[model samples]
Each structure stands twice: as structure tokens, then as C-alpha cells.
Target: MHDHRRLGRELGLFGTDPLIGAGLPYWLPEGAAVRHALEEYIRDTERRAGYRHVYSPVLGKRELYEISGHWAHYSEDMFPPMDVGGEQVVLRPSLCPHHAVIYRSRSHSYRELPLRMAELGGMYRAELSGVLGGLGRVRAIHLNDAHIFCTLEQAADEARAALDMIRGAYAALGIRPARLRLSLPGPGGKYVADAQKWRRSTALLREVLDNSGVPYEAVEGEAAFYGPKIDVQVADAAGRESTLSTVQIDFHQPERFDLHYIGADGAKHRPVMVHRSVIGSVERAVAHLIEVHGGAFPAWLSPTQLVVLPVSEAQLPDAEAFSRRCARAGLRAEVSGERSLGARVRAARLVPYQAVIGPKEAAAGRVALRLRDGRRLDALPADEVVARVEALVSARRAELWEAEGGES
Candidate 1:
């Protein structure tokens, strides 16, 4: 296992202080960079999947959770209550209830039967202090959460779309598809509401998986109390499995919240809801990425993508010019003007790759790219260098990308 605390401190990512509340992470610049990259990727992906982003308050009336049934099933994981104007309020632990409210705020017709709402859901769950680790486990987490309100007939299609989004996300992060597993909710009391509904929902999910030719395991009693879900498990470098995403079918919430839409028959009918997350929690995904890549992220995902080292003071101008060219090409490049080539290279290894340019390269109008593993690709044009870097980052080719960094 990666020494998470050491990695966080060494990378200047984030750290916990005794004075600061436990389980809450204060992101430093580097950490925030990684987080922002993740957010941008997920937001773009959600948009491509037709999810409308929305924001919800951090706190809501206690009755919201009560109606959502979270008060009964997950109350232990919630924060302490607050008395507000003779009514109880609580921090929002999930975004489903808020989504329900948003759905009801606008009148709906069968024409808009599949409305998908997404949020980078910042939520609080009262976890034990000891369980919290750097960006892996935190008190407050931003979830790539979304809810799809679809006609009962559209549930399967909506679920297939959610799974596709999840796969796309993992691929963008350079995670192998084979290492991720999907789990269908098991039989019995694992799901809330009627047994008949559970059976029907499971059948629907199974059909979706089969029609899509997506293989999934049927795990018993592993779903949330409110609904039957398709749970995603990701395997790390050491083959340890972690829950990363979920696609759930909810039949109860629409009824509990008294939500409905006008149907073809001009009658109000309850719409089925699909709850999903590509990356379950921002904090968790960061932690997984750290281990998955062994703290060496790909170019696009790297906090500091490139460090330019000048061989001597005379080469500073060339180094600056090269770095500027890289920046123009959307590569994060930094100039190491004051440091020796060797020292700069050593320091750059702390990041991913170093673009070490010297007088020879300046005279040649080319640069030798240094990989983190002590190999050098010599005498490549500045534009070719930029293109290669961009391709590696954009593709999220972590294995080759990290090896490229290591070779330098």
C-alpha cells in the first residue's frame, strides 16, 4: 500500500492537522489541481451523456431524509441534528432527496420522460476519525452523483447509459476495463420495498447487462436499502477490490415524495428513478488513482505535468522558449533555470517527467525528452515533443506515460 500520508505531504497535496476537524481535507494547490482535473473530466462526460448539472444546499429539513428513508436506513452515518426554527435540520448525506425536489419543481410530460440531473455532490457522512485517510476517506466528499427520472419503460436504457458513462470515466483515467467488475443486487431483504419490485428491478438490470453484453456478477445483499443497484468494483495494483460506482433502480422514492408525470393516457404516473455515480466520491477516486498509478499520474492528470531543466545558465532562454511552446500546446511546463541539470532532473522525478533542454538542443532547435526511468529520447523537434506529450496525456496512457517519466 502507498504511504498515503507521506505521499500527501511530499506532493503538497493535503494534510490533516489536529487543530483542524478530522475527516475534513484541506486541499493544497497540487491536490486541488488533481481534483479539478477529475471534476472537469467527469463534468464533460456527464454533459456528453445528457445529464443536466445542478447544485443543492448542504443542509436541508430533517423531514427530507425522513421521506427519503435515509433517516431510517442510514441515520447512523449522518451528522448530529441542528434545531432550526422548531424544526430539525441535518447535513445532506445524499443528493437523491434534493434531486426529487428538483424534479417536482418543474411540471413534466411524457415527452421529457428521461430527465437526467447530475451534480458533483459535496456531501457529509459522519465517519469515524480513524477511518479517514488523506484523500481516500474524508468527512466531506464530492460525489459524481446523478439521478435519472425516466418512464418505467425507459429504466433499462437509462441504466445502460449510466454504465457506459462509468466505463468511459475509468478509461479516461487509464484504468483497465478488465479490472473493473459490476455487481447486481442480491436477492432477499437487501433492497427495501416489495420483494416483487426487487425481482422485477433485478430482471431489468440483468436484461440491460445482457443486451449490452456487459458481464456482471450477482452479489447477494450488497445493495442500498432503498433500491437494487448495479455496483461497480475496481481492482487496484495489488488486486484489492474497492467499490467505485453504482447504478441503482429506485421505485420507492418517487412514491414517497409523491412525484409523478403526465403520461400518454393523460394520467399521472410515477416515473422510475436511476441513481448513479461514475466515481463514487472525489476523495476515494483520488486515493485510488494514487495507488493505481503509484503516485505517478498521466500528463493530463498530473498536477505538474512537465519540468524544464536548463543544462546551464546560458541555456535558460532556450529552456524558457521551449517551456512556453509546451504551455501553448496545453502542456503544463515549468522552467528550472536555477538548478543544475542533474539536480533539476532529480527534482522533476518527484513529479512525472522532465523536459531537460541544454545548449546542444538550443543550437539544434530540438530537445531531448528525459523520462523518469532514466531513458532519454534525444534530438526531437520541439513541436514533436509537444505532440507526444499531448498524446500521452490525452490518452491517459498511465503505464507508458509513467514509464516515460521514470525513464527520464
Candidate 2:
């Protein structure tokens, strides 16, 4: 097992500075590139899935959470509210309340059967110092969050759509689904005291899961305070299961926030709210990827997908120029001309593809390609190299080198 903390340092992905406090990781340039790639991928995927992205504030008035019931039920996990000009405000613990406000800002209609609002929102939670670790457990979190406002009749269908999105994302990332947990409220005061609502929400989720033909285990008292949820648990390389994605059905929040849409009969009706996240938290997702792939990221997600190495100082210009061309063509490339050829090649191995610009290849208007897995391609034209790599990136292939003609 590759320790993510050590790999993170060696790869220059991220670091923790004591001055910045624990569980707050500052993304280095390399890590930021990975984060950016993941963010773009999720955004594009959600857009194609009919989700409208939005930006919400990181802090909200205390009264907002009060209305949403977080103040009473989840205050211990929240930071102490700041007294801002005689009003209590706290960093948002979740994006649900803010999104509820967004849906209420304007009148919606039945024509908009499913109003899907999404955001890569930041959130804060006051974790115990002893429990805080790397990106997996952090006080500052970048959540891949979204909320769906729909009619009661559309709730099950919307939940099914959310499940499809989760499955598609996991498949793309090469993650195998380990289990499905239908988390329900337990016999405790921690949950909203609405037995009727809980029964209805849990039944709906069970129906959705049953209709989808996916077996799941129902666990009591593990649900969000407002509702029941379906959690997609994936096993990491070490076979430890973690919940990476969730689709929750909330009936309490809509009633609390007075959220409504005009029905076809011309009367206002409460819209059922569905809370979901395809990749739960960006930081945690990257950390999971690091451990799952053992720091050898998929070609499309790697920070430095290609590194150009010059055999000698004489080939420096060609190396730099080729790297720039790759960058211009939307590939992450860099020139390694600082040390001996052998040393540079070793460093370049940290990346997926290494292109050697030597006198022989430069004269031929081509470069020698060496994959991370020790396969070599002799004197391929620069354009061909770029085209091959671009195809891999476009397809989001997991491996850079394939035994069968390097297609991946």
C-alpha cells in the first residue's frame, strides 16, 4: 500500500504547513492541476446530465441553519458563529440550506419538473483535532454538491437519475462499487422527529433501489438529519470501503423553507428536495485516487502527463519547444533539461510519458517516446505523438502504455 501522505510529498501534489493549521492542505502547482482537471471533468459531466451549476456563499446567517434545523441538530459539528454586526453568522457546514434559498428566490413551475442546481461548493466543519488527517478528513472541504427540487411524483425518477450519474462517474474513474447502503434514521432525537415523513422517504428510496436491481443493506441511524439516503460505497486498493457518493431524499427541508412550485392545477405545492454528490469532496476524492492508483494517475488526470527530456544541452531548445507545443495542444507537458540525461529520464518516469529529444530524433523532426511502463517507440513524428496522447486524454484512458500497440 502506498501511503498517500508520503506520495503526496514526493509527487509535489500537496503539503500541510503547521503555520496554516492541521487538516488544511495547500495545493501545490502540481496538485492544483489535478484538482482543476477533476473539477472540470465533474462540471462537464453534470452539465451533460442536465444540472445547472451555481455558486453559493461559504458563510450564512445563523438563522438560515436555524430554519433548516442544523442549528439545533448539528451545531456541535459547526464552528462557533461569528457576531457580525449584531447578527450571528457561521461558515456553511453544507450547501443544502443555501441551495434551498436559491430555489425559493423565484417561482418555479411543473414544466421544470426537475430543477437540478449544482455547485462545487466549499464547506467548513469543526472536526476533532485528533481525528483530522490528510485530505480524507479536513475542516476545509470542497464539496461536489447539488440539490434537485422536484414534485413528489418526480422524486423516485430523480433519485434514479442521480444513481445513474453516480454509477457513470465511478465507472469512468475505474472505481468498483462495493456496496449500496440505504441509510435511514434510527430511534433517536438526532434526526428530525417526523416519523411519517421518514417512513415515506425510506420507502421511496427502497423502491428506487429495488427497481434498479441493485442489492443494498439498510442501515438505521446513518442518514442525514433531514432525510434518508442511498450511499455508494467503494473499496479502495486496500479493500476498505468508503462512501464516495450519495443521493438523499429530503422532505423536511422543503417544508421548513416553504419551497414551492406552481402545479399544473395552478396551486402552489411543496417541491421535494434531493441532495446529492457524485464525488462527495474534491480533496477527499483526489486522496482516494492517489491511494487507489498508487499515485500513478490516469493519463487524463495526471498533473504532468508528458515530460520532454533532452539528451544533451545541444537539444535543450528542441526539448523546450516541443514541450511548449504539447502545452499549446492542451497537454500537460514540461521540459527536463537540468541534469544528466539518465538522471532526467529517471525524474521523467514520475510522469506518464517521457519524450526524449536527442540529436538523432531532432534531425528527423521526431522524438523518441518512452512510456512509464518501460516500452519504447522509436522516432515517432511530433504530431503523431501529440495525436496519440490527445486520444488517450480525450478518452480518459487509465494507462498510458498498453501491451497491444499502446492504444491506452
| Model 1 stretches with alpha carbons more than 4 Å out | 1-5, 176-191, 212-215, 235-240, 350-353, 363-365, 373-375, 380-384, 391-408
TM accuracy, model 2:
0.95
Worst 10 residues of 1 by lDDT: 176-185
The Cα local distance difference test for each model comes to 0.80, 0.88
Q: Look at candidate 2 and give me any clashing residue pairs.
A: none
Q: Which lDDT value does model 2 have at 376?
A: 87
RMSD of 1: 3.8
Error (Å) of candidate 1 at residue 17 is 1.2
Tens digit of per-residue lDDT, candidate 1, span 289-379:
7776766786678888888887888888998998898888877778987756677677778566677677788898888877766667667
Clashes of 2: 0
> Which ten-residue region of model 2 has the weakest summed lDDT?
399-408
